[model samples]
Target: MELGVIDLVGGGGAMVAVNDSTRTLRRTRSIQLDHVWRALETGAWVTAGFRSATPWLSSITGESPSASSVTLRLAERIQQMPQVKATFADGVLAESALRQLTDLWSFDIAGEFARDERMLLGWALKFASGDLTMLLATWLLHNDPDAADKTAQEQFESRELHLSSLLDSMGRLDALLDPEGFNLVRAAIRHLS
Candidate 1:
């Protein structure tokens, strides 16, 4: 028994069809939103392609559409924050970290420091790990206004040392690696800069 099928045609729209075996009836709906139809089509193609290429994904249920949709919406909301966008564009923030920050807090940190986006981006990039970045964002989100200023100052000072230690470790590793491998690392660091 056939269940349902959805077809998205570029520049046209989405065609959805449902078949009911018991009633011997078929229903169809056309969705005209081009952007929405295109997104759905892309998502379907990605899911089918991934499932076909990965043998294990066929056995286990893949990432749910609802979850991916939520993440995409959250990312769109986060991008509205100039500081968040800047950090992400600078390669200092990971998409997963931004999602975690969105899940942890509702307020806009970027709006809070609209004039200090550079400072905010610098602080965000100071964290060597995404977990640390999320923790810092959470701290900033929940801290009282009076304490936030002092806390931000202290966090920056303390985190600077941590970042310095991380850089030292990377430098040591770079010294040990082959010239070609170290050159790749240098290129990545240059790209981040």
Candidate 2:
């Protein structure tokens, strides 16, 4: 099977080219939340090629073609956090809450908090109010007043969320397109530079 290519630009953006049996879809966009959503949609459709049971079409569809299992795995990973686990186990974690919590996991601070489960749980609760980023900024400001400015923190949060969304989309796409493992395409476009 011919795999797609995802080229990363010098400016930290990505351009993806995916080919399905019918047509080829190429997208050039910034690494943002909306762009990731579009990638997910496109990947879902391209991956749908596997849904066809016809043997001839199966060759180009790649192996291990199913996104449902991968989605479940993602949900399970999110549930590993103590707070998320409890909320999910108790049925208190709705789709929106789950999404927010998962999104929060994309931040670098999440790894730091992971070492202390109690703190992570507290932050998870704070995530519900949409103040997690603000609180993190406040902490950073307290630690390094000169460096952790509000604007920088905001940009950091935005980048974190964008990356999180991108990875989430890529996971979905990989589940459908390359089930064995993630096959990230790398390319260099001089024009983008």
Candidate 3:
């Protein structure tokens, strides 16, 4: 049964909603924030209107040369925020927000990462595959493209992989997006197009 919903703005920049069942609808609560609401509504409309998209927003966040270091740092901070993280865990953040947060978090995660026996991307790619990485990267960047480094340009410069192994193991960047996230990327591609 559809439950009655109440949007309740809380202290500390948080918004909450109590469903008829007393559970939270975090996505609905996020819409109470003016800027986030705008991002979500606009992204949703773009997706509905355009079915074919190129994920320009995602690309811009992670690989665009024009993005600056400061932007990426800001994105990382945003992703790390408690409210945003909670919303994300609850599946409330918009598609773009999720991508943006994921991208920024990746940068932070990557920096602290120490890989000896296990490569982070390799682990992700092996069991989870590149699509998951793609999805996570998309979410992180869509939330903030400027926050991601232009690693796309330099990925090859720094990474020395046995070409055969990489080719055999690497899944397509496609199929990475989760359903909601996929829709967001599609809208981003269309909006930019």
Candidate 4:
């Protein structure tokens, strides 16, 4: 499936437009991503509801999603590759890794900060390519204590709501990865750049 950027969206099927060609993939409103997780593991949902955007996807004639919602959802999913990789890699993950990875890569993909763009891209590509060491070290880049602590710190005191959402998703994902597994540190990581 074409795991690229999404342009237009609306409420029959979703369309994924690549640099050269454009293709449409059909989906259903009930095609919840969680169901995809039900049948597979991480990186397995490569083209379930995403086929509409990626022409190479198999025809999953299960459900139908409006063009707008599917397009938006596909785009959102593609956007989370970096953080998802972070969440799946072995070891306990903190919310800061999720925030920093998302923030850095989102800006990179959007081309908002060319000066710092390459730096984020490098980290994302490394993470996606299974660079476990770099993914683990990402937290170090965010946390600071003395001259800035490189260690992960708890954020339960200040960002209860933020942590709530972050943990909710990560917690669900954690369970998906390991049904009996769960990470409850309950905090977001802060990166000092």
Query: Where in model 4 is the C-alpha error above 4 Å?
Result: 1-100, 103-116, 129-154, 158-193
Candidate 3 vs. true structure, TM-score:
0.21
Task: State the lDDT of candidate 2 residue by residue for 1-193, as single tens digits.
Answer: 2223334555323332222311221111111223333434466435655443222122333423232332333343454466555554443333344454454443445454465546645564447445765655455454445543544454444321111134446532232222112223222224345
Q: What is candidate 4's lDDT per residue for 1-193, written digit by digit as tens? A: 2344354565213553332222111122223333443433444435344433322122343222222323233334434554343332322232233334443333223343334434544554345434634553453344321212212121221122111134446531111111111143222212321
| Candidates sorted by lDDT, best first | 1, 2, 3, 4
Model 1 residue 86 lDDT?
49
Instruction: Tell me which of candidates 3 and 4 scores higher on lDDT.
Output: 3
Off by over 4 Å in 3: 1-81, 106-150, 153-193
Q: Give candidates' CA RMSD values in order.
A: 19.3, 19.0, 19.2, 17.9
For 126-192, candidate 3 gives per-residue lDDT tens digits of 3333455665555446544654455553333323211122366864332333445557769998999
TM-score of each: 0.32, 0.30, 0.21, 0.23
Greater TM-score among 2 and 4 belongs to 2
Q: Global lDDT of each model? A: 0.42, 0.40, 0.39, 0.33
After TM-score superposition, the amount by which residue 49's alpha carbon in candidate 1 deviates from its true location, in angstroms, is: 23
Q: What is the lDDT of residue 27 in candidate 4?
A: 22
TM-score pick, better of 1 and 2:
1
Q: Candidates 1 and 3: which is better by TM-score? A: 1
Candidate 1 runs further than 4 Å off: 1-62, 66-70, 90-92, 104-110, 113-117, 130-138, 141-193
